[model samples]
Target: MHYIYLHGFASSPRSTKARDLSDRFAALDISLSIPDLNQNDFSHLTLSRQIQQVEALFPPAPAPVTLIGSSFGGLTAAWLGERHLQVDRLVLLAPAFGFLAHWLPRLGDQVEQWQTDGYLPVYHYSEAKELPLHYAFVADAAQYQEESIARSLPTLVLHGRHDDVIPLQASLDFARTRPWIKLVELDSDHALTDVSTEIWQAIQSFCAL
Candidate 1:
């Protein structure tokens, strides 16, 4: 089985959660591939582009793949699983369902300005500086629907009950009708950084790693 990890938006392969999981997987003598989703160009990031990039990293079929993603990356993984049968399982950490809806509204009137300017200055946690991301990012993300991700598989979603970024209701709604998905509500916030051990334990039990 091949294990691949995708980091959250504006985050990198070296994120706190990514490194924590990587170290845990290493202790088990397992190799985890965490790709840098930014690809050195945060200026032109799009959800479709992210899906394509991660798709290229997947090993050939029959190898059995497990995807572990955080936040926006988690949303990307869900779409990937829907499109590729090669994805055997998914571990979503606060997956950004209803991402555009939650984020766009926060921009308020600036949304129009971003469209006119063609870019928005968003703070990238990994880079430690605000980056000018093209408006295409929002446009591309709007094309994907959380409801359309209907692929049935062994999926585990760990969401924070107090999540303000992507409200817990988003995951609750997504998993409500999907019997294949197991939703575990954690006592943490959006980052879930404080409860890394709980997250890892759930992953081990669910994935049997």
Candidate 2:
């Protein structure tokens, strides 16, 4: 089975969770793909392009592909699964569900500036900065219809109970609407730094199934 690991917005394959998964999968002789999606202009890049890149890394339709997406990546995975792209399973970590509602307004003038300047400024909420501007464009382009999408695919959703970024209740609502969805709540925050073991366990269980 092939596993695709997608990082969160403004994050890369070199992120802590991505590197950890890569190392663990390598030791088990399991193949995984984690691509860098932040190496371009945020306003110009679309979610379709990222999906195409992921498709190129894997095989064509009818082949089994498991997607593990974090934050914005999780939202993208949910969208892909809804499109019926032959996904075997989906694992979402602290997915940004109503991102367009949250980010687009906050980005305000930056969005218009992106249309004019051809790139959006990377907004830094905390100490960590320096991510690609195209990430915002991708986020802007994402549309969440989890209720319709989760019906067709087996989904494992991991969200922190204290997730300040994306509310945990939103994930619960999503799980409540879908029959094939499972929810695992942890005590950590949005980053899920302390729940790696549980996350790995969930992945192993889903992959085995």
| TM-score, cand. 1 vs. native | 0.99
TM-score of each: 0.99, 0.84
- For candidate 2, give the lDDT: 0.76
- Alpha carbon lDDT of each predicted model: 0.94, 0.76
Off by over 4 Å in 2: 39-43, 105-118, 123-151
> Which residue pairs show backbone clashes in model 1?
none
Off by over 4 Å in 1: none
- Give the 10-residue window scoring lowest on summed lDDT in candidate 1: 142-151
Best by TM-score: 1
Tens-digit lDDT track of model 2 for 97-173: 77666667777777776666655667433226643454446454654345556446889999999987788987887
- Model 2 clash pairs? 41-134, 42-133, 42-134
- Candidate 1, residues 159-181, lDDT tens digits: the string is 99999999999999999999999
Question: Cα deviation of 77 in candidate 1 (Å)?
Answer: 0.3
